[model samples]
Target chain A: MDNRPIGVFDSGLGGLTVLKEIIKVLPNENIVYFGDTARVPYGPRSKEAIIKYTFQAINFLMSKNVKAIVIACNTATARSLKEAQSKYNIPIIGVIEAGARTAAYSTKNKIVGVIGTEGTISSKSYNVEIEKLDKDIKIVSKACPLFVPITEEGWANTEVAYLTAKEYLKELLDQGIDSLVLGCTHYPILKRTIGKVVGEEIKLVNPAKETAKDLYDILGKQDILRTVNKDNPIYEYYVSDIPEKFASIGQQFLKRDMDDVKKIEIQKY
Target chain B: MDNRPIGVFDSGLGGLTVLKEIIKVLPNENIVYFGDTARVPYGPRSKEAIIKYTFQAINFLMSKNVKAIVIACNTATARSLKEAQSKYNIPIIGVIEAGARTAAYSTKNKIVGVIGTEGTISSKSYNVEIEKLDKDIKIVSKACPLFVPITEEGWANTEVAYLTAKEYLKELLDQGIDSLVLGCTHYPILKRTIGKVVGEEIKLVNPAKETAKDLYDILGKQDILRTVNKDNPIYEYYVSDIPEKFASIGQQFLKRDMDDVKKIEIQKY
Candidate 1:
């Protein structure tokens, strides 16, 4: 057992979904979550830039003596996870692998649909991972660019979300996919809207849920699970910009209060 | 006469609206447009971060020997215009002044509505500018955070856009605004839909139009309008990240072919 905190970072508030799951599953574990609010939506950025930003995030979290790092953002993970794992000594887990594995295990018809940002969909990381699991599996990928904004605006269950989801998932649904992977960190929040659009025929896989379990398994195996006896576990959130806006939007993703948040210059890391 | 190009920069592609207006009004002026694609949404960032990023954009433009600079993004202008004007040697113009003046002039009733990103609205720059023109003028400002994404997705006229616009503009419309300021650079793209929601009675003041005219007046007063007589006037476009996606999505904003776009590391500037 270890007392060092676990580090988790995402492009922005979307990662709070992952952090929320992490807190729920690992109740005693202290988390150092960083949201790169200054330069978010890593979806449209270059792979090199994403890797650079991911390293900067890792650098910041490592400063707090985190035992492990989780790349909570699908775009960041798809663009940089392997490279980061090769370079860092501490075990690094990315959402793509766990999410893909879960989809692979959960699917009965061998047809899977992926919905995410332009970067993650275009990266084809989910497709590659699922294909690696089974050569005959069929993959359908579509980019739902407006979903982030819809979720960010807290219209996840609203009519706008349903319309937008229907518009984006029409083709994928028509393709007869049995299981769908929410490939973006923010996608999980829109699961209800997405489920409504796809109906009861398709199963939705949230990477956050699987990623939390992945972290738990890895921590237990490595014997680095937080063993501190402190009555209250503190989670620290660092953002590159204003913390109030982060806290407000973050509440939507977290579904809880983020009482301890700080504004830091991420570039300095 | 100064033959150098006019520098126009925004947090992202929204500035293309301003550049489009500039192109239509002043066809002879060579233009250098920079979109901070990597750090696109300055809307929720801190003032310090916005100022820093704005300077980096300014620094990059200055390197290209631009004669004057236009802060085309509302968030950037709201956060850093005054500081930028004081610090930079070249003439700098921001959208807020021209937008406010136009709204002030266009409104039959003193009640005006301003819609923009969170940073632009929260800064109270539009209200302050309009109030400076007439102390008794009533201003209703709303932060339409999802507008940028709708415009970015090129869904300006779609049903989702209509619904989103209806949702955001409901409060402003109920407040009985006679004239509305398109406070953010991107808001002009959603003009038709906005007009549809607000009806033909409420006049929409586009900052891009007024900003272009303001540029014309400033260039004439300074006697620095481009006098170069090349066969084809060059409009160099620079962005902080991948140029391919910018060229594609930018066509929606620019409504023209962008054959000369280059990727630059904005952090270096």
Candidate 2:
């Protein structure tokens, strides 16, 4: 049984959704979570910048002696996950593969809808992965760029959010998609609003749950799962910017007190 | 006459709105504009990070042999403008000063409203500046963080934007503000929507226009104004990330074609 923490990193606070699931699946495992808040929303950045930022995140997590890493952000996963896996020895899992797999299998009409940030849609990572799983599954993709900000603003369930979601999802609904993938980590937080827009007919697949399941399977299969202990497990939070704002917004995603978040200079990594 | 270019930089495409005014005011002058697209949205970041980024932007602009520099982003200006001015030899101007001056003088009821990003509002630069100009003027400020993303998503004039404006401006409207300062660069792009929400009774002060006037006065007083020449004047655009995205969004902000945008590694500066 290994005790080294599992590291999870995202561009910002959105990854806490994935971290919440990770904590549930691997309750006794130590965890190190990093949020690059200073330079976030990697959605509109160039591929080179995303890859560079992803490597920096990996380097920071490696310094914490993590056994494995999870790229909780779809933009980072789509743009840099392969490069990160090739460069590091630790088992690194990204959200795109599990999300694609879930969407490919869940769709009854064989037409799946993928909505995420501009970078994720442009990378076509979900399309590639979903197509590999089933050649017949058609994909309809759209970039809902405003959803992240809307969620972060705590307007996830507001009329503004509903309208934005309805506008973004109308095209996908028109395409007759049976399943919709919440491709970006932040998208899950707006699930209720999104559900109202799509109604009960469309199935929503949140990648965080699938990613956590994948991590759990990998740790168990590799014989690296932490031994269950009654003692309180360590859970550390680090951010590039000040922790006050991160901790405040983080409470929304985590649904728990974020009291001991530390600040780190991510670029130095 | 000094023929050197005027350098204007913002966190992203938002600054193109300011650049538009700079061009109109100083049509004969060469211009070099930089947008830190890779690390845009300095609003939620720490003060230290904003200062570091502002310095990097300044260094990049200085390298281009600019005669003067404008801190076109409100977050950067509020958090780092003074520090930047002290560190650099070149004349540097920020949006806060002109915005505060305009709001303080324009308000007949002595109650002015200021709206910007979280960083700008928290910095309280506008309040401090306006207070210095007229202690009697009551300043009401709010940080509308989602407006940037809404504008960048090209939904500035949409129903989503209208609802968002109504929600954000309701507090200021209740406070009985006679004039409002569009403290953030991106807010000017949503002027029509914002104006519609606030109505004709409330005067809107776009800092970009006042900032251009301030620059014009400074150049004239210092005897550094560029002489008019029928020859083609240079206007270069630089960003930290890829140019394609910046160019596309920039056209909306600029209201003209963005044909020549170059990418630079801003961190190196």
Best candidate according to lDDT: 2
What's model 2's lDDT at A107?
91
Shift of residue A231 alpha carbon in model 1, Å: 5.1
Residue pairs with colliding backbones in model 1 are none
Alpha-carbon shift of residue B159 in model 2 (angstroms): 1.5
lDDT of 1 by residue, B54-109 (tens): 99999999999999999998888888999999999889999889999999988887
Off by over 4 Å in 1: A1-6, A27-32, A38-68, A83-90, A223-242, A257-269, B1-5, B28-32, B43-68, B79-90, B223-245, B259-269
Q: Which stretch of 10 consecutive residues in model 1 chain B shows the poorest summed lDDT?
A: B225-234
Please report how far candidate 1 places residue B70 from its true position, in Å.
3.0
> Candidate 1: deviation at residue A7, Å?
4.0
| DockQ for each model | 0.38, 0.49
For each candidate, give its TM-score against the true structure: 0.85, 0.85
